[model samples]
Target: MTATASPTHDAGARAALIAELKRSAPHEAAMRIGLEPPARAAEVLAEMNPAMVQDILEAIDAEARSRIAMAAPRELAAQWSRNAAYAEGTLGRLMDPPFATFRPGSTVGEAIENLKSLVRTAFVTYGYVTDPEGRLLGLVTMRDLLFNDHGTKLSEVMLKDPFALTPDLPVSDAMRLTLNRHFPVYPVKDEAGVLVGLVRGSTMFEEEAFEIAAQPGAMVGIEKEERIATPLFGSFKFRHPWLLINLITAFAAGGVVALFQGTVDKFVILATFLPVLAGQSGNTGCQALAVTVRGITLGDIPPGGASRLMAKEFLLGLLNGAVTGVLTGVAMFVLASSQDSPSAVMLGVVVCLAMMGSCAISGISGAIVPLTLKRLGADPATASSIVVTTATDVASMGLLLGLAAVLIR
Candidate 1:
């Protein structure tokens, strides 16, 4: 608990520890590793999630926590503590404390002198100008600091009413706002516009990138925690449940086909088109799903935008279905004529109509599945592919068989 920052520590070990801490769930896993007697607990903790660090520190022995915190420079420990109070996915969770600041009346010489000491343990990117109550007024760039005369007051040189991110802003929303600005660091403010902390562009982007990367796996029921580096047993533990759920959904699709066994038996050729229809419908749904997920991830979906998104996807599916249907219908007609069937023309027409209808439903399912999951407070992409696949399969096979049963029977 009282260990100082020793010069010698294992780099590999520290990195492994940090990776495990990041991969850990509920911060409890982090707490166990946090209690490990690393040579520099504070520094190791600093490299990890602030929210996790805060939870781990709070869970451990108070004496140990305080001593470990004391080992780090005051600014970092304090910042991590404050950042923990925010939710895991918000900007506040990623902020570092604003260590270098000066009052409006402070001269450039005074700011430079203070930064001389501040840069030793921390990276000083920009100097902040704030009122006595910590309301952010402006930002003083390093170039402005050096070029201007030492006698110039901070108020005169600083950029007034600087752009800032609110702590509660979701990382996706933050990314949308800052995509073009590309500033090295952004100051974070509370609802009252009081400067609270700073978020590095690198850190913010990296966090969002991890979420975006996890989306592919999440779509098919893969747990977000599984990574290429994950242990075999751990990967199995993460994936087994989702695979089971996917199987269950698959059975639902199968059941729909089974219910119309008589229809399929009477018209053996119907079996041929079932898979084709199902595959086409499933692909259409997947396309819609991908776009909708991307929109949500990038914060492109506006308020009450769900209906518009679904409608757009539906129209695209309708157009695509009609085009692909003509080719499929021609194939159906050729097969039926070779068999000398009486209803060749009608069979082809049924296939075309079924394609259009199934695709329309599939496209809408794609948008609805993820949107519904998000509304239910689950990850938007989690098991979404499974749900959409089931919906499309049932619609495709059921529609093709049902239409033939009614019109041809």
Candidate 2:
């Protein structure tokens, strides 16, 4: 015979267990608790990371996973499974199944009763009105349902010609749409215009936050999926390739310096300025790269806009380079005069010209690298810094040294 605890004791024990599991054994605890009741499991899993939830679901036995899926709300389960099937950054992965939906003919009284039931179990922001074939027609808010006559049909009261996103839309593109007017929820339809899901503003906000947060790491070759909880080996695998690439680029910069060995030997001061030139040009390239990447991500740069963007960056680079180069040239002149060098004025001219040219080239390289990579179907942010840095280093050092050899010697 088993001793049974009172309802209060059972509730307390379950809460305590859930709290402990959430802190330490999130995956295991989710699996164990998710098996108890479908609604309860969905509720618990909803609060956890979506990626982790999907991982746990995939790792569990098929039978168990199926049961949990079945136990979840119809729309919630459908959305979760659909999102799992999509690539990480697509809009499909960011949308949830429409929790509250009604047919065009549904009466106001029926819609209200349905919402009353759904509100208890899940979030109910707006009720989607669909046709008999599941094609999205319009939307009805709770306020509309409450203020209207009870016998009124949904089509008569709902907002017509609603905005909808297709499943294949990129998450970044979806974000662009939400910037102006933030709706509480936006409908998602299939390519055929059949209603499939809802994208909550809150959910989209969270995904955008994650994407923005991941960018710094992404620029340095870190995988977007990597987190503090990622395994040591996983992190190693993600990081090693970028490090090796950096080493190769560093060698290329060194080789440029090696080619100008005579210039460095004749004027050791040129070697001292090599790093200063590289630093300025490299920062200029990075600034261009950052702005270009942002423009691409936000959909601000439309088709055929790349040429204009490049031109703008190049002109800005020229202006900035001229100003900075004059300052550097003055400094070099003062240094050379202090050393009583015969070619002090010529050295200043060479340095000034080299700085201007290097900066202009760096800016162009920065703007083009990401755009080129994007055209080649690669991620714009992936390894972009490495390529930009390498280009700037080679350009700045090669120009400064080669010019010094010709003009100063």
Candidate 3:
């Protein structure tokens, strides 16, 4: 009789072959292998690259995908389906259902027994106590369960009214809540206040950190979904729009300079300082934009309080402008004097006034652009740098050259 391969050996060999196919072939082929055992497909997909898993799932045939979804565990299906249901940056996508929970009436001994079994397969940090309707009541830490009497009721020992996150809350807002109150796991609730899942604080932190790191690129018009593995054409499509916008803005700045061509020719020295003024003002605007975006993301700037925030940024702009303006004026005075310009002192005064005005406007523009976008229901970081830079460039050039035309003449 021919020797038979054990079920374990056969499964292991199948898994190995599927993994190799996943690495070497299109995701559809690997997904077909996963489809063979629909019940295990969720686990296999979870282990694969999450960045591409959603696309892979979409590529599968509708009937096969539906069968796999039906066969998978409810929580696993929910997690996989979250991409379609929730907005990309919400807390729902970061939550998982693989958590330890118990009824409020369960005894400490029973909870411990349940945990013992779950601990072997899942990460068990806290025991959630919920009411009959699955509304969360409290939490019991592992340490509490260990130290309490085995006969104690979980309801009597649990910490009531613990911090929880709603499913629709943005992940950035969720992260701000954890800055002062750190918990390993936070319960997630639906609109009805029933506990739906749990979000790991570490996971939220990682996702938020990645988002924050990507903000600079996002400001420059890079898509958040574009990864190193993105195809060449994909990257080109993602990047072209921003470049076109930047080009248009550049032309606007050039138009401002063309309007001041007469002044630039009369006082060639003024031409030398245009870039200096624009660069300084652009940097100042970017600083304010960074702070405002961070504040908006963290929920620090509440609704109806944007005016106050804008006022603060505006005041900061004026103060920073005055300080930097005086120094810049002195440098312009010295440079013009060395060049023996007849209107050296007047040129210094013109530069000082221009710097102050440009810096002030840049600061206000930075804060206002993001806040306005948020109010209009657009992404605060979507090509904001392009807009703000264009504004500062136009303002700086218009002020500097216009002033030179008036004051130097």
Q: lDDT (0-100) at residue 176 of candidate 2? A: 82
Q: Which run of 10 residues does model 1 get worst, by summed lDDT? A: 25-34
* Candidate structures ordered by TM-score, highest first: 1, 2, 3
Model 1, 261-292: lDDT tens digits are 99888889988998999999999999999999
Please count the clashing residue pairs in each candidate, in the order shown. Answer: 0, 0, 0
lDDT of 2 by residue, 138-182 (tens): 999889988999999999999997888887877788888878878
Query: lDDT for model 1, on a 0 to 1 scale?
Result: 0.85
Instruction: Give lDDT tens digits, candidate 3, residues 331-380.
Output: 99999999988899988888888888898899999999999999898889
lDDT head-to-head 1 vs 2, winner: 1
TM-score winner: 1
Predicted structure 2: lDDT: 0.81
Q: Residue 255 lDDT in model 1?
A: 91
Taken over the whole model, the C-alpha lDDT of each candidate is 0.85, 0.81, 0.81
Model 2 misplaced regions, further than 4 Å: 1-42, 48-71, 229-233
Among these predicted structures, which one has the highest lDDT? 1
